[model samples]
Target: MAERQGIGEPRFERERQDDAQASISWLPRRLDADAAEPKLRRFGAERFEPARLSLWAMAIGRDPERPLAWLLAADHLPRALLIAGALDPRPRQDEEALVLDGGRQPTQAQFERWWLWERLARPKRWSLRVQPATLRAVALPLWLGYSRGRSGAGQERKTRLIVLSGLSGEALGALKPAVLAGLRERTKAQTDAFRSGVPEGTPEPG
Candidate 1:
């Protein structure tokens, strides 16, 4: 188990400022921005921001028996399962953070397909009769570091986005594309909704 930071800490003040615009239900995060700052600095980011990514938790195994749990990213496209170990999720509100709800919730059928593919790679697990035992929404904490291009000082400094897992404090280079795609889609949906005078959180038109 990882150590969790209490909400009363002074470091939360900076996180609150960084994520003032977004909020959502989140799983209790073990790592805080302050604790992840030193690693984030290595990216040479001009500034670091805190954010959250929506994920779906599903238990897949024989019904009536305890099943293995998995976390799937809520991105528009299907992605490999995230490497999250045992989680003790609890509701903790009043924590301000930028929650990215840009991805679609993966359907049960999608999970089945992914499971089959995964099993094919592991022949020994083929006999395991698995199914989605339960499904629910959850959020993973993330840190976004914004760094400028290393071009000449006279040249414009284009900002680059670097993502890291707030849980293990590891850089998520492979998931960067998916994260960027989700952000773009979310921004587009919000813009479209605003233009049509629709309230925020309204489902985008099909």
Candidate 2:
């Protein structure tokens, strides 16, 4: 397992398209055992957990030894939104931007579909800071929290996700074409295997 933690600053920018302001940011991978393990457990659970994939990515980014790849399945998005609302990060309907933090625990699924297209961005968009030593698959749930600015000026929504494993910068770059291609290839393979192993069109008795 990878250990050691560091705090890296994320750069965020606003991208307004079709009258919606979308925000994107990047965080480095520098995480300690205490921080990394708990995160992993929450996100790795088999329950109907709430969480933001972005928040999970941010937590991983805070540590340098974690894998660089994250899989955002469709079933777990509601959990992320509930956490976001509880933290009261305050979604901007005007700008269509909501920055969630990994601090609070959400009860309901909110903002689940706001990021449908965001899932397609799993492999290509994010830039990795550090390479992972090993890749382990685990299911962790989301932990949500909110940090309010003094005098009600602002509030920040926080979320954290612990995953099975990620790709290291070096390991990823060693693949083919480019690092992202490598990550995508690996993720795709894993997903394909998972799908293939599932019983297709099986009916469950009610």
lDDT by residue (2-119, candidate 2, tens digit) is 1112245222211111111123222223233345345544444222222222232111232444433332212223322111101112332232111222222211122223233344
Model 2 regions more than 4 Å off: 1-22, 26-34, 38-52, 55-76, 83-186, 189-206
Kindly give the stretch of ten consecutive residues in candidate 2 with the minimal lDDT sum. 12-21
- Report the Cα RMSD per candidate: 13.0, 21.2
Measured against the true structure, the TM-scores of the candidates, in listed sequence, are 0.65, 0.19
For candidate 1, the lDDT comes to 0.63
lDDT of 2: 0.27
Model 1 spans > 4 angstroms off = 1-25, 61-65, 116-130, 151-155, 185-206
- Please give the CA lDDT of all the candidate structures: 0.63, 0.27
